[model samples]
Target: MNILELAEQNFLITFSVVIGIGLLQGAIMGRGIRSRFPSLKRHARSASIVLLALFSINAIASVLKFAEPVKISVSELTIPETIEEIFTLIVNVMGINAGVGAAIAIFVSVTLIIFLKFANIHQIARYFIFVISCAVLIVVLLGKFTDFVPTAFQIMLYAFYQFGITVGIFLVTKRKETDVLSGIK
Candidate 1:
């Protein structure tokens, strides 16, 4: 109805689109992995790294822009102060910060995995490392969701930015044969 309301509406729709796209991407990627099965299994570590790298890039972006202004612009439309601030915080914090942290977690876990294998460590350490990775991944997702936007659309947009970090790195790093490429032979 009004200018601010309109801006909020647009913001909602934009993010919703992102989430929808994310679901679609996940489905397609999942199918690809499934079809490849055992062959794709070999690529797991690299794939995890890709997710981490993308998330980390986003986190870096978030850290860099944490104190920046609200960035809302569409065609000739502009957002009001209150709405802009909310979205701004969401992007800089939840979208970026959380993502970067997740990436680093992935890297650390992957490294440990490689070292243990190389040194001929037992199953105990490997299991612990796997648990740690799961913990990091869960924490990141929880933290991201906790920084909720006001509406359904906001959630979608934020999800888009959040998942963008995960998906981007995944696509980029996935070319490698191993997830933990650096430590291996």
Candidate 2:
């Protein structure tokens, strides 16, 4: 196959990978939160459900966009205008659904973090907030600076951010040594 064909194959693979990893990460985070904060277990479950629904919708939109890519008319556009148009097109193609999903995810994550902070889990909340902030910052930077990056690569990067969140939550909710030892006995 030619390079274009190879890239297309890779793109589909990457999309699938992102979806799988995202689902797994969501499950992990939900379980961790529920275990760590029994009072907030329902909140964790609701967040996970909402996130999953949003992500699933976004994934479907992305696959549809990939299958039938959108075409634009740039003949009358100047350089700057063309750039803007292209950026808009890219955003549309790369799941405006995803943008909405990310926004909701961020809101839910921040709310959870706030609850954690108020509950006196200061250090864990700080780390989780930091990870979420970094993920958002990196995504914004990528959107601004990497116009040349492929859609598949951008999706993969999003998956990486989800993984980071999972890791942060894992650290936050892991059983203490004393708890582990007591359970062992």
Candidate 3:
């Protein structure tokens, strides 16, 4: 296995997961909308359907393009030409010891958002994302003297995770479909 291969795999895996996510989102949103205000379901259905289509096409194309080997603005940064090598490069750059754990963590977070129903969920989840962002910021701050990690990269990834999580939640739970909204109708 090499970095290029690993990167390619990541790209494919990412696209596949996003598609799976789209299906999950549709189911959850449908449940939420129908259970809450059945009247709105008819209109909301179309919007959610369109969202799924657009999301699938965009996610797949973006990942495939991103999987291509690329150079970085930072010093001595060249992405591995193979997927396996890409994993090594990622591990080396992030100082991440585990190879598959990052993907697992993302999946776990998504699962948590899906199965758990904490109070003020959207705000709570946003706060959770904020905490994640802060943790990344702290790591970057601590790594200051080291030449390896870039602060900019850390910031970017943090923002990416935050938005990604938010979107994931949106895909999984639609505003019209929530149990909380049921009483209002």
Candidate 4:
């Protein structure tokens, strides 16, 4: 069978795997955040619930958007011959409007900045992440409103979004071990 057919047949499994990975990533990031900012340890359960709810909404919206058939015109079906062309094709398929794309870019930029500020990582690594995230935002904004930026940079922006969301999900989900032991006792 064709790849599309296989994907259609295993949609449920694919969705589950994606969500499972997101959850795992979120949990790890949350623990890291809590370790870095001990003030958040007191609100782990509530934070987890809020994050889970947000994730559920996002997943539902994604499923709803993709479950329907999409129509592609003949001109749009041309195969991309180069890496740059492939990236452009992917960006076009995402179909984000300029205004929405700009808003998302801004939001992602702010989120990444906040995450990097509080992330439990080495200073050098934090600086690298901060610089890369800002660069990705700039590239995404230019790509959205102008033609000078390469669409391949949009992939980096999306990756930042994924990381931000995962970290947000687990931001306060890690309580101190003593708290857990006290509850058990």
Best by TM-score: 4
Worst 10 residues of 1 by lDDT: 64-73
Per-residue lDDT of candidate 4, residues 50-122 (tens digit): 6555554443433222222133344556888999988877655554322443344445445535764676645
Which residue runs of candidate 1 sit more than 4 Å off their true CA positions? 1-4, 10-14, 22-41, 59-159, 165-185
Better of 1 and 3 by TM-score: 3
3 against 4, candidate with superior lDDT: 4
- Model 3, range 63-98, lDDT digits (tens) per residue? 322232122234566757999988877755543342
TM-score of model 3 vs. true structure: 0.30
C-alpha lDDT score of every prediction, in listed order: 0.46, 0.47, 0.43, 0.48
TM-score of each: 0.27, 0.37, 0.30, 0.39
As a TM-score, model 4 comes out at: 0.39
Error of 3 at 114 (Å): 22
Q: Give the per-residue lDDT of model 2 (tens digit) for 155-178.
A: 554655455445434433343321
Cα lDDT of model 1 by residue, 22-127, tens digit: 4433333333332334354467566657546545554444333332323333342445469867686555543434454545644544543453455432354345
lDDT at residue 83 of model 1 (Cα atoms)? 80
Superposed Cα RMSD, model 1: 16.5
